[model samples]
Target chain A: MVKPIIEVFDLTAAYGDFVLLDKVTFDVRRGEVFVILGGSGCGKSTLMKHLIGLLRPAAGRILIDGGDINNASGQERADLLKKFGVMYQSGALFGSLTLEENVMLPMEEFTKLPPEARRLVARMKLSLVGLERFSGHFPSEVSGGMQKRAAIARAMALDPEVLFLDEPSAGLDPVTSAGLDELILRLNKNLGVTFVIVSHELASIYAVADRVIMLDQTKKGILAEGAPGELRDHDSNPFVHAFFHRETAEVAG
Target chain B: MDFNQKTGCLKLGARLDAGEVSALWSAVGGRVRHVDASPLETCDGAGLALIWYVQKGGATVTGLRPEIAALLRPFDHLPVDPADAPPRDNSLFGQLGRAASQIWNDTRDQVAFIGEFTVTALRCAVSPGQVRWGDMWVIAQRAGVDALIVAGMVSLLTGMIMAFQSSVPLKQFGVDIFVVNLVALAILRELGPIMTAVVLAGRSGSAFAAEIGTMKVNEEIDALVTMGIEPMRFLVVPRVLAGFLVTPVLTVYANFLGVAGGFFVMMALGFPFMALWNQLVSAVGVTDVMTGTIKSFVFGILVAGVGCLRGLQTGTGASAVGVSTTRAVVSGIFLIVLVDAVFAAIFYTIQW
Candidate 1:
């Protein structure tokens, strides 16, 4: 069995008086595409933020590569941060920088690579996402899908052990979104990088996810956990079944 | 990682990551002909990049690790070429030509914006019910009422400083009584209106630019246009009207506060309160106050108009709103000073 790259035990997330997630327990194994899927307002984004240490969990622990993310400090914390990369829903590329410069920013900050080597590495990362041709273009100049791809390249700049994507296919069309899924699969297969994707796109989930955990807004916990196909075909939970089958809860109920 | 200089062979280590591979390139150099990856246990993207970098330099890498080979295979066909450099115009004449063109284009845009605003203002004037009175009231409270304290404080300090400075030199010539005339003339004719206008330029002008610029960036303005709404009528007119109405009122209030400040200095200098009041009434007239009021009205239009113009002219990208805001403040102050100079010349020529 592959060792878990991330271990979450009894994680609780809340915003002040309102709790969004409660006693959420899950583990992501090394080199697999693990997805968190739920409908709107289901706390998928909240969980992703907590996993990346952007938000503090109200209760429980999150362990990334054997180190407790909450307890680590100083150099240890910086080292832990370098272990994962995040691509936000908006692509979040700096408007002033070209795509190559955006990819090189992480390397410039974290590595001791010479300028020439850094440029070459940035080009390589862009090439990985098929964005080498648009390296000189700004984020505003590219299509939404291309910007997302450039963002992925920037995320891979430091060769993080895990990559977290928030709603990667939310605004993309079927073709562009499928292309992104293919890119994600290729990167995972070739580099053996773990992917933690937060998405509700059924086609994308079935295409790339090795394992998935479905969260429920009302229950504030995982409703189902299994392969996408298994959950879609045989899950007993009404909410999980409704989600996978694209049926309203009323019909499934 | 170990590299044999004489044998032209590079040996990989158990772990190759970003931190460990930084020095790998320097050690391998260009002389590397073969890479021995049989001993390699783990490699990341950066490590793969290093290997690819060597392979692209014509070195043959031999290894039995299927996993690492899979990582390198995808990028193997990608050509190792440098990115195209951004174009630059380094010559002095090229730079001058660009600057001249930008200035000419900016002047043309400014004139066109003024024409458009004039047409909108006239249309709104014809149908007064079309104006957004609620938005105008809100802008009035924000730009005028909220600004009273700062405007009054600045006016008061200016009056006090003028009185004290003039009194010092006048006392030397036994003409200290003339200090009241000097303070009244300066505050009512110039200081009050100019100070109030400057405050509005910094406060309301920047806010207008930032608000509109953000709307432009978010495509909200485009949405308004698509909905058959003119942005100038829907947005700029209300703010401009509120500015035009409030500036003169603020200027009058600032003028009173400035005179009060001068009264304090005169009282502190042992001059009788009644004597200073009588002197001020005789020296300052309705025209003196009217000149400042008229200047404030024009300054108000310039400041608010420039802000709205900059906002509507906002470019695309993350820094667009920021750039527009900066331009609003700069252009607002510049226009105020230029128009004030014209006002000064007219007043001087007429001996007002």
Candidate 2:
């Protein structure tokens, strides 16, 4: 079995009195595209935030590469943070910077590469996402899909081990979303980078996810976990089945 | 990672990530003609980039596993030429030309905005029902009532400083009691209106720009336009009218506070209250007060007008609102000082 790169044990996420996920546990293997799925208001985003150390868990621990994220502080926390990158839902590129400059930002901060080398690496990363031609364009000058692609290039700037993507296809058309999924798959297979994605788009999920964990609002925990195809065909939880099938569950009168 | 210069063969390690690859590139300086990936177990994006960089520099790579070969395959067809790189154009003439064009474009936009504002304002005057009195009242409270304490404090300080500075020299001439006349005339004619407008420029002007600029960025202004709602009528008119109405009143309050501050100075210097009051009343005529009030009205228009104009002219992206707010404050103050000079010239010509 592949070694797990991330381990979440008995994790509880909440906002004050409003508990979202209660003692949820999961593990993501190295170099696989792992997705967290759920319906609206199911705490999927909250769980992703907690995993990325944006929010502290109410209970339990998150171990990333065998280091406790919650317990690490100062340089230790910064070192842990260098191991992963996050792409936000809105393609939150720094608007003032050109695409290449945005990609070069992390490398400039974290590495001692010369200016020319940093520029070359930034261009190469943009080329990987097919955005080399638009490296000089600002975020507002490009279309939404291109912005997302540029954002992915920025996220891959330092070649982090894990890339956490929050709703990579939220506002894109189906074709653009599929292109993004293809990029994700290519990156995962070629570069062997692990991806932990948060998404509810079934088409995107089926296309990129090697494994998935679906959170439920009512359950306040993971309702199902498996490969997308297996879960669609065989998962017995009604909510899971309904979600995978895109059916409105009929309530018992 | 290691490179043998004699054999022209570069050897990579088990983990070839960004940090290691960067160090290796700085060392070898892309000098290799051959790469042996036989010992390479894993390579990341930057590692792939290094290989591509070497390949682009005419290196031959051998012994790559099938999976790694496939990863390197996609980057093969991409153009290695730098001809398509974006132009920076940072020469002195280039910068001057860009700045010139930007200023030209901003001036044009400001002219167009002023025309639109004038038309809308006239329309609102013709049909008062089209005006948004509710928003006007709300803006009035925010731009006027909320600003009183700061405005009063500033005015008081200015009055005290002016009286103290003039009294020192006037006392040398044994006419220090004339400080009352100096403070009253200056506060009523120049300081009160100008100081109040400056405060409004910093506080309410920036707020107006930020609010409207945020809406412009979020497409709320576009939404209004699509709905056939005139943003000028719906958004700009109320704020401008509020400023127009509120500034003169605030100036009145500021003038009172400034004179009171002068009176405080005079009282401390052993002048009786009634004597200072009688001197102030005799020195400051209704015309002096009217001139400041009229200037405040015009200054009010300039401040709010420039703010709304900058907001409506906001560009896209995260920094757009910040840029607009800054432009509003700067242009507001600039126009205030410019028009105040014009008023000063007019008053001097007319000898009013």
Candidate 3:
């Protein structure tokens, strides 16, 4: 069997007396979009931070691309982070950078490539996200959709094998969210990069995800994990059913 | 409603909203729309209401899908454009004139992160590079200009006063020669540095805090950290270094003007200018002027340090800017006095 790109074994994360995530064992394979669906306080974003080495787990290990980050040093963790593109939920674009400069940031920091090469890479990445014309625009000058795209381009600038997206479609209109979903699919198939997306946007999830990991609050752990259609058909839990079909079910009744 | 069937799980992203238009926008989505919408509305005491016209551009822009952003690129409907925007906000010009200094602070933070090792090493005490050349430039350019403007104006008036006040004493004692020393020594050592820093603490120092504090409240700081930047090196060091280097020069200038004032007074009272100049030279010591220049340098550091530190302490939101600016000025002046007292105590003890 192929080794999973990411592995979380018996993970129990805590903050003071509060156990944020308990015994969360999961594996995300290479080159597939996997969505983690949960409510606001269900510790999903916290979980995302842990996966990216921004937070530590109280118990258990997180191995990314088969290297253990739970036991890694700070330098090692940063090096590991360089391998993954993260488009933060809030579109964490630097205010000092023009949209073009924001995309070029990673290339500038981690690579020895000169200014011309870096600009070319930034332009290409921007073009990938349909933001090629906005290289001169600042985050404030562009629309919200464009900002998210530029952020995505920045994340992809390093050409990572794994991408961590925290709520990629959080604030977008349904149409824009659909466009992002399409981009993720294209990136996964074309670039062969693994995606670990934390989102509760139902339409985007149903439109894109190959598999789902539902964090059940009452249980404080994984309630279900499987292909979207399979979970919808077989999971007896009403919570599982509501989430898998949230797109068709949320707005109407 | 069973736990599963409730299906409210999707609202997580929107829950961070604590604002007036929570219904329309949430989290990352909220501010962009509000910032854009501001250009389209006007305030006539309705407490920041959105006019119907506010939605007109949004509608047209949204309908055109992709073309309208290209078409409306060159115009601004809002006054001052909120004084925040990249390229504009990131430049030296923006740092001086921008209303939203907090935004600039965050942007500078990104620079620090990129140059973290250089910044971290330079700021370390091994070399005592707490002072930096970039900071020297900013202080010389921005803070220096402010100090000169205020000190020059205030000194002119102060000189006028010295001339007027010393006339009576000089006429009676015919010791008008002493008046120049009194003005020069008093202004140089004690009054000059202290007064100049106090005024700057109110003017430039507070302005620094307000700008940085506003960006803090806006999640601009968060943006910097995620991008691997340090806010301290980019934002704090430059301004702190500036204040440190520039304050002493203004203090010395104030001293010269004070002596000029006394000279004017002595001449008006019929004590010859040459006589006054000679007597003042004889009465004054280099120690007195040196003591004041040292004090001014210390005061300048205090002013800049307090301003930058308080700006960093600002929380997210517009109101935090005002709070941080007040803290910057108050703490700067307070620290200046505290340092002055320490200097006074040490000098007396050493002399004994």
Better of 2 and 3 by TM-score: 2
lDDT for each residue of candidate 2 in B113-172, tens digit (9 for 90 to 100): 989999999999999999999999999999999999999999999999999999999999
- The residue-level lDDT of candidate 2 at B104 comes to 100
> TM-score: which candidate is best?
1
Tens-place lDDT per residue, model 1, B225-325, is 99999998999999899989999999999999998998899899999999998898899888898899999999899999999999998988869999999
Clashing pairs in 1: none
The candidate with the higher DockQ, 2 or 3, is 2
- Cα DockQ of the candidate 3 complex: 0.01
At residue B266, give the lDDT of candidate 3: 62
Q: Candidate 3, clashing residue pairs?
A: A239-B4, B101-B211, B102-B211, B102-B215, B103-B215, B113-B229, B113-B230, B217-B316, B217-B317
Model 2 achieves a DockQ score of: 0.50
Q: Is candidate 1 or candidate 2 better by TM-score?
A: 1
- Report the TM-score of candidate 1, chain A only: 0.99
Ranking by lDDT: 1, 2, 3
In lDDT terms, how accurate is model 3? 0.69
True contacts kept of each: 0.53, 0.47, 0.00
What's the DockQ for every one of the candidates? 0.58, 0.50, 0.01
Per-residue alpha-carbon lDDT of candidate 3 for residues A94-207, written as tens digits (9 for 90 to 100): 866788788777766766555544565566567667776678877766877778888888888766778989898888898888889998887777556689999988778777
Answer with 2 or 3, whichever has the higher lDDT: 2
